[model samples]
Target: MHTRALVLFSGGQDSTTCLADALTRFERVETIGFDYGQRHHVELAQRGVVLREWRARFPAWAARLGDDHVLDVGVLGRVSETSLTRDMAFRMEAGGLPNTFVPGRNLLFLTLAAALAYRRGLTVLVTGVCETDYSGYPDCRDDTMKALQVALSLGMDQRLLIDTPLMWLDKAATWQLAHDLGQRADPAGGGDALVQLIVEHTHTCYAGDRTQRHAWGYGCGACPACDLRAAGWARWRGERGAG
Candidate 1:
């Protein structure tokens, strides 16, 4: 029932899709991005570009978008030795978690987001966390988020709705959702506006390479993030063909 939402956006495919979905469902949407000294911090720049493009493409919806916020949690990088925040090589942990997993990253993000939302009088928090086609990050799990939501509510003493539109969706299904959102936002009343915005403006590469452009987007194709995105794109294409 909340009309306003704050999204934890990363300027990646999943988060970007979540943002578009938020625009359609909420009267007001704001985004918060973090600068935790991650190697792929270039996505922060892409976040600005994506917001600007969305504003230009759909003025009505864009008007509803609140200012994008970037928090400097770089201290996390100093304290955490994860591949995402440090120069260490990426690998899997003994229990099967990726080395890129920054302990309590999502927890801190959601707590910060909830604080912001409370101050802004927003009642909903949307995130792009997906269990279907994502690294084995325990924080991305629905149960974890739900537990955090309850904890946040108890701590803040206010009701906050946490929405995860892509929780049950695979990467290909996510791509399709983005496409569907684009069609809904198209000024012509039917086109790929959302998908186009995602491909041209968003950044998902963990390597933070802006020079290497592909059919999917800019990325160092060899990185795990890029590989996952490419695989999703391929599956999406195949599904389209089959349909």
Candidate 2:
């Protein structure tokens, strides 16, 4: 069993969920975030808030929580003109991908994450990349993750297992996963606490609009990130109500 893990956390709902999952699965779990000069840099700020909430509310996971590292990869934003990194309006490109799809963004993140994991003696690398309910970013696909896993292991000469707990799960299921994880950590009120932490503190905004409030979370409520999160939350809550 891989004892230690490093999650590629972005302080978004997805990554935040992955972090919670990691804290439960691994004996020790660390987090790594990237500052790619994206338009929604606010997520970086929100990362701390999520961590603090979890530490204060969930003692079980807090005991397992390790260090958090944020790397400044501003070069990615400098080179890419995508809507996520720039102030431009969002649109679909003729090549059949969203303008927010930053080429090689996930790849670079995993590469850097693997390097950090190697130095830190972490064997498992967890990411929130999901093709199920995400933009049509090729890098978010399962194949890309598998290939990167092999490549990272071969390149680093270490057994680095890439874990994608959200690969097959939709946004609602992702939310449910967090709920379940929280319950395991703190059975009394952990489920609601974790879900509340995500809805109130985490971010999934493409435009980084924290002013607007929504049931799902904080976002512009218009970007693809917010749309997925909102729709997922509605579906999950709707089903929850029906059940």
The numbered model that scores best in TM-score is 2
Cα RMSDs, all models: 1.5, 1.1
Clashing pairs in 2: none
Report backbone clashes per prediction. 0, 0
Candidate 2 per-residue C-alpha lDDT over 28-61 given as tens digits, one digit per residue, 9 for 90 to 100: 9999999999999999999999899879998878
Give per-residue CA lDDT, model 1, range 93-208, as digits (tens): 89888888899999999999999999999989999998989998899999998999999999999999889999999888988998887778765843377777888888888778
TM-score of each: 0.96, 0.98
RMSD of 2: 1.1
lDDT of 2 at 73: 98
Off by over 4 Å in 2: none
Off by over 4 Å in 1: 187-191
